[model samples]
Target: MPTTPRPVKTVLASVTAAVLLAAAAATPAHAQSPPLRDLADQQGLRMGAAVASHLLDDADYRRTAATEFNSVTHENDLKWESVQPQPGQYSWSGADRLVEFAEQNGQQIHGHTLVWHSQLPSWVENGSFTPAELTQVMEDHIDTTMGRYRGQIQTWDVVNEPIGDDAQFRNSVFHRVLGEDFIAQSLHMARAADPEATLFINDYNIDGINAKSDAYYELAQDLLAQGAPLDGIGLQGHLISGQLPQDIQQNIQRFADLGLEVMITELDIRMTMPVTQQKLEQQARDYTQVMDACLAVSGCSGVTVWGVTDAHSWVPDHFTGEGAALPIDDDYEAKPAYWSIHEALGGDGQNGPDDPGPGEPGTGTCEVAYDFTSQWGQGAVVEVTVHNGSGSAVQDWSLTWERPSGEQISSAWNSLIQQSGTTVTAGPVEWNRSIAPGGQVSFGFQTTHAGAPSVPGGFSLGSESCTIR
Candidate 1:
């Protein structure tokens, strides 16, 4: 959430400047140059932005959202904390304003979230309730919230961030009490409330092929197999500049292959502070890559940037030394990234390679590359790389190898690791969790050894024996 609040005067000034700029851009010569919404509509894409309800009071802010986007998501107004701060007491003033604005503008509403571990009122988090009681409470909230909007909101993020960065179900209250069944139950309740609405499981860090995404892939399949009303998967594409995932298109295609709609929800690319021309250019490229990936996939419905402008971006407050995330700057000027997306949407959508479609399940074939980067009298550093040739993405990958009898790992990075006796198990962290087909991720560890350390054997990726290199 954005912590710093802007004064009404400053916000008005920025909005005024934006309106003037928009007027200038709409001259007769530039009339053919459509706003993002017009371009997106041509390609059957919905260009959207997460909007602040209060900002809509300003004519320019409202105009910007109405003209540039065909979809609107309330940045915080629709969250659990915002709508239902007190148990059984609902507040809809903020959300209602946004909904009305969207309606007047002919825009689709994407319901932010019905259930999330964050922004939850203290009562819900601290209340001592049994599994059955908690389940009822959650279902009631879903019913009330969704039933209110019903067909107005086109899509709903029924479950948010159920999977943690460790590539496992988060130990949220719902999970701790009701277990994984909570997800299925929530989806079922949402479905019953509004049969016409599309329900999605939304999470961050699953934008590309990785362990976290693999978990979602498997979960989507399981839910469908059991006849759960799971309509889509929302990949919160909150990214960092210069680090766009290489296989993002493949990841989206894989999810689409499961016969589910995929959306790049909450998209933003933040960079380190003191923005430069070079950094902005890279940001444009990153935005282009994400939009291109979505365009290339038929099932990828749209791309929604997290916020309307850098003035209210959550990046600076949450991430130290990071800001300038959105396509619009603090002064309400469109940045290069905004134009990049506009151009991509208006031009041919063939920016990506011909889709090879989804890959088949691999034979669990893998390779492990181990090397001693440095060695000392009693301590040594080793770097290990795990390659995935499984043809399909591997979920929750675990690497195991035997270390010398007395050699023990003291410190490790880039992985969750533990040693039991002579065997060491390493699993992917949030960033390096998923290894794309024919791709690899590397992690290093420092260890203390007894005498001269000898190369350890019995290396394996999951149950498949890896050919050591």
Candidate 2:
């Protein structure tokens, strides 16, 4: 059911789009204008896109993705047939290329899938292995592939599209062979392969409270009780024109309360082709609402659009007569949805009255937020988000924070970390160095502790100190 109002007729010219693209490219890196990635960073969440391996060679597509997003998921290259075409044989060239590119750009790589019903190689799809035999095959596949990437990838859609809208497990090969336990077994294998990576069960049509998502919630609770090593749930936010999920926040919060981080892993709103002004406006509002929902929930870690640009989007091919599903258009220009996301992220360089904490005396425009993803008897994963409220983009950022007396910074992700004595410095990698006005950057670290873990205070970005909240 549609929840928002339909848009009035609006139109845009090609010339205007060209101008927007020029302005976007010409803006100096240090200017106050920030990209969507910067905006998401300020909220302690990630903004990402799904990229095909071949698209990395497209300069225009590559530039837009590198600048606007902090994470990348292989749209298809990491899938079954693409990676392993023959039994006991593998192909790593395509997947590896994207991995190297993401590493060079300081973008986090999200392994799209380890198990999926579609695109399976003929060998695996046709092999008439017994239930016990098939379980071994699946386990071997997970172990071999996950072991190759190890800790380089941050998250894995360990099992994808598992549940149908009818609230029952889909008739996928793994499900047929191993029955209900395939989901749990796959997750455990992924965790064993990469102990640090976050394992997620990803599915589409789970954007809001419904039969499909409910089934996932129930299954997740069961898995957790069985100690199945599930850490997150991915809601593929593929929406149609004028149709927004009304209970998005509540749904995400419910899963979060289950001790799992939720992600909008593949977000894009599709509409009729030859886009109209009204449709674009509607799209903008839709994108804003989605980003706002994630921001409102402490457990929502990130949002990933299905594609970076309409020129390369899968919507057209996948949905007849429906296209224009990305923030960037085919002409390499920013669309209405781009500004909508910007507005939602507070990219206007103004610190709202609701800022979580106060800024330093001279740094009136900065804010900081802190939270723990998980904590246990001897260790904890802490998330830190730095918001830049200045009028110009920050090209180079350096933050200083003291490590708690007994806490040791064991590892960090999404940013570079350095330590000297008790003082720890964190900075953006090459890809995340620029912070737009009112934008932010988020990073997390695992700490080793002898006693109960405590949050670290006294944070600063560059010479200007931040108000730790």
Candidate 3:
């Protein structure tokens, strides 16, 4: 079902400037918004999305992908059918364009699917060959593909969807001709081609402790015992709204126990069509749940949403009466899911586009407003906005507050934060150091507390007492 890739348009400087101007006019707040990639980086995790090569021509699509994600995956361009459609013939233009885009944007490339049962070229699927010849063909494919991008691709799905719902190996061409040995062989060949790349076996429906996951767990143990080169397990979290697996953290921890990294790959929470406000809200909570599950597990490295926006989501074509599976709308507006994910990644957690932020207009020289953006059993995200109500601009402002006993500040963003004993001081970073007379700057921090979170008071700006709201 892969579409033919269109010629990628190289964005000229003039067009790029125009696009930026148009985008700013359309959504001015986005310019000051902290990107998801920055928030995820603060936590030592990556936020990624799958990219359709054809969509790179769209300015909005390209801009969102470049700004929001730290890693990129080609949706179909790197598949066997897309890359090699004929015997001894390889097409690299579409794939190369995506790689170039990722490199230019400083994003890591997750080379998808060196081997899979689906999306195979007709020559590979319909060819008549003996087991030895077929094995040679597979090895050659891996060598050529992996060798071409050895150091550029940080990780790869060496084999994909190898196990079935019935907890047995699928009768794929590789499995049918060479039995289960083909998986180990593919891993070995991939390692030989790119020794530094992290190799993974990816699949769907293994996000929890189900029979399919059990099968993979056993298979991984056996492969490692036999000295196969395996480094990670990819759980494709293509889930329905409100149906996230309850034991997601446990499952990730179990895989981590195997001494292999775990990643939530191909994540999308789809719902029935004619999307409603309630459905969208539920989807937001579901997205936050998935982020929380990943953040809770030490071995879970990152997550990759399947596509950039609902306009480009594949759910409608595949699932009848189901759509709206992404964080951005068709018009390039941020959905509730986007804010949920932002807060989950330790952002300031402004409610939505219309949110006026923390406080009303004040007559005092400086005013501070504090709000608890998100709270769980033991953790909370707090946002403090510093309003510059003075007639003149405020330069290089610093704020001080006392931390409540038994509360611990884990991480913060948009400022330089430090604590000694019960007192905490925060100063603006270079980009946010100056605030106009009527402008305000907000900073957030994540904290762990016992019982309910205690609010810190007695705020001061430089040597002046500030009005609190």
Candidate 4:
């Protein structure tokens, strides 16, 4: 019988879907993009990181999903029990809501796991079942869960952590009865159910196909030779600063050589408890190296960190004395990790993943919309309106720009700003002016752009609200 996994919170929601448009803004005058941009933008290494609990409630998660990432995976959203609790009884509400949320946000979804010994429901592990019965239960679970997410999830961890660091399979019930065949069987079941979905055998300890990775690697190769359904190998990269096993990239490439798409799933760099400057810097270096590996390989899909913010990380809960493993801080503030990823993806984080996206730069209670209308070479007049919905004043805010060409900012209106590489800064757009609850005010800027960021969706006004036209 599978056991019920501990859930952090309710994953169900009634999400309203709406279409949105982008506001046209004149490109800032005399601005240029960074000359030394990271290779990610050109290669399209889709940006993503796991989210914290705060994101689940605020509209930020949707915005984060839309702008920064092309694909989103449940940090703990798609655990085994969340899908199947009792035999043949499946719950689609939580996972369904997540899928809807991802779709509305203009992102793709990845199924976390179809089989994991850790989070299995109680019945599946202890329930009365013979060898044949267990296999049937396994088959049923895969068919139902994968069938529901069939095409929506581009990749599914058909089996997660099937073996320990030792060469043998872990002591899950499946191992006791179905024996080592459980892995091959589970893969077959998931593949049969969702042939279109990419099936991956995911596990940690394989960052650089070491002994543990090799065991799984050999297993995967043998299965492929026998014509089993295995699409990719997911490298669970939970590395510390400066210590990504030397062969990690080579391991990933080696797996790719076996004719499978390689993904750096669950990639995060942790540090000693109170994060130090050295660790943070090393974290940045490690992150860049992983991106280098992905860029070096041809079939690398992309990297997905376990979570974006530190608030809801699985590290503190699971790994002792280790914290701050993700890119952004709990408040969704940009850390070195965030900047590293952006630069890696050709984004000089002047104006980051839409102000409305989760893990974005703004505090999304007050509505702020800006309009830029001017010639490309002229100082543009951008009008910004700050509408206060909640009883608060946006003490500080700023609008920044990055040009497409390799030019730099020679001048700016605001002095309290700093320019980074090709990114030009203009403000700590301090609204010493306050907007009373339900009141509104407007502000403007003079700038230039090679082009404007597409507000691909619409202006997310607040929770359950959008300014759709």
Best-fitting candidate, scored by lDDT:
3
Q: Mind giving the per-residue lDDT tens digits that candidate 4 earns over 400-454? A: 4443353333222212334576553333322222344555444333333355422
Indicate the worst ten consecutive residues by lDDT in candidate 4: 21-30
lDDT for position 429 in model 3: 61
- lDDT: worst 10-residue window of model 1: 349-358
Candidate 3: misplaced stretches above 4 Å? 1-15, 24-31, 351-469
* TM-score of predicted structure 2: 0.70
RMSD of 4: 12.6
Candidate 3, residues 123-241, lDDT tens digits: the string is 89877879999988998898998888888889999999989899999988988899999999999999999999999999998998999999999999999999999999999898899
Clashing pairs in 3: none
List where candidate 4 sits over 4 angstroms from the true fold.
1-42, 51-55, 349-469
lDDT of each: 0.77, 0.76, 0.80, 0.61
In lDDT terms, how accurate is model 2?
0.76
Q: Model 2, 5: alpha-carbon shift in Å?
A: 35
Runs of candidate 2 exceeding 4 Å displacement: 1-32, 349-469
TM-score of each: 0.70, 0.70, 0.75, 0.69
User: How do the residues 1-469 of candidate 1 rate in per-residue lDDT, one tens digit apiece?
Assistant: 2323333332453433224333332111121134576578778887899988988755545556765787999888888888888989999998999987676556789998898877788888787889989988998899999999987899999999999888999878888888898999999999999999999999999999999999999999999999899999999988999998999999999999999999998999999989999999999999999999999999999999888778778888788899899887876667788778877886332212121111222333687767665565676656676767777877778999887888877545445677777888888655455677766666655567778866777688888898776
Per-residue lDDT value at 201 in model 4: 84
Higher-TM-score candidate among 1 and 4? 1
**lDDT measured at residue 157 in model 1 versus the true structure, 0 to 100:** 92
Q: Can you rank all candidates by TM-score, best first?
A: 3, 2, 1, 4
Residues 1-469 of candidate 2 have per-residue lDDT tens digits of 1111112122232322223233233211222245666666677678899876676555456556766777899888788888888887889888898887676455788898888887789888777889888888888888888999997898999998888779999887788778999888899889888899999999888899998888999999999999999999999999996899889999999999999999999999999988999999999889988988998999999999988788777777767899899888887667888777777776752222232322222344677776665565576656677887899977778888888888777555445677788898877654467766777766555566788887677787788877766
